[model samples]
Target: MTDKAVSTIAELARDFGVTARTIRFYEAEGMISPERQGSQRLYHPRDRVRLKLILRGKRLGFSLAEIREIIDLYDSAPGERGQLDFFLDMIEKRRVDLEQKRRDIDLTLSELAEVERNCRNRLSELAKGREQA
Candidate 1:
């Protein structure tokens, strides 16, 4: 392997910013195919790149299955059109979901503000009652 490639599990994990267990999990999931050198896992440059993409996908809220599908598509066809289309679809769906979540959060915040106001008003009223008493 070249100098840029990872030759051991520790090197792969360090380069990818993941745990060794994560690499093993990805291997078990068939998301990556690393070579075995005397019971030690050796990752090449391609595996390193794939691991990066997988972690990025996870951070972007993509399921493992979805990440695998996207990665497979990219690996199978080294072009932009299909990937762009898929990304556009995913982005639109995520946008709509986020909009709905924003609306829900806004409503919850408004409700919380009302509750806080009411609690403060009640406390003030009770203080006034004690003063009068």
Candidate 2:
């Protein structure tokens, strides 16, 4: 099978639904490296895949540093079992954190609903009192 040899900034941005500035920011952060052809930045297939990973990581709430670490691990020695183990540990931690956040949000929404109900009941009582007066 053949692969895409190169990609332009505009093409990738359009395909990924992100702005060119966002892709440039990732380049600045050392997430992806693209070759410069005069004033144009030409992204290789590797860069394109890296960008995909970076965007996916960002969407999953990973920090740039965390994403970089994971990407670096992917490029490290193939026999490094410890790196894979570390990545697994990181995934578990992230899962736990996200689950806790979900629980907190649910609790917050429940509290808000209760507060709204109380406020509505108070307003209804106030309206009844005014009518009786």
Candidate 3:
């Protein structure tokens, strides 16, 4: 099969709407390996896809270490099934964490609304007192 097209680091960064520094940081973190053309870095299409997944994983609250673990699993020698199982475990854990966060946020919003109502009532009472005076 013919090799896929590769792009310069700058091109990849522009395509992904991320900074070159961010891509380099991922490389430093062992998240991706780009080909080097002298001092310049070239990224294959596979690297581009990996970068996309890395960014998406970050947005989903995955830490760099966690993302690296997941990425490594896919690249592991034993098999993809083991990695798939590990990913499923991670997904389950994240679901629980997200549910807790949702509950906490709901509670916080309710408290905030109560505080706002109290403040409005107090202000209304103060305004009435001033009007009477």
Q: How badly does each model clash, as a count of residue pairs?
A: 0, 0, 0
* lDDT tens digits, residue span 44-108, model 1: 88788788889988887888988887778775565566766786788688779889999999999
Residue-pair clashes, model 3 = 0
Q: Give the TM-score of candidate 2.
A: 0.83
lDDT of each candidate versus the true structure: 0.83, 0.86, 0.86
Ranking by TM-score: 1, 3, 2
Higher-lDDT candidate among 1 and 3? 3
Which candidate would rank higher by TM-score, 2 or 3? Answer: 3
Please estimate how well model 1 matches the true structure, expressed as its whole-model Cα lDDT: 0.83
Best by TM-score: 1
RMSD of each: 2.5, 2.6, 2.9
For residues 1-133, write the lDDT of model 2, one tens digit per residue.
Answer: 1257988899888878889999999999888999999999998988888888788878888888988888777777763475577667878999999999999999999999999999999999999999999
Clashing pairs in 3: none
Model 2 scores what on Cα lDDT? 0.86
- The residue pairs in collision within model 2 are none
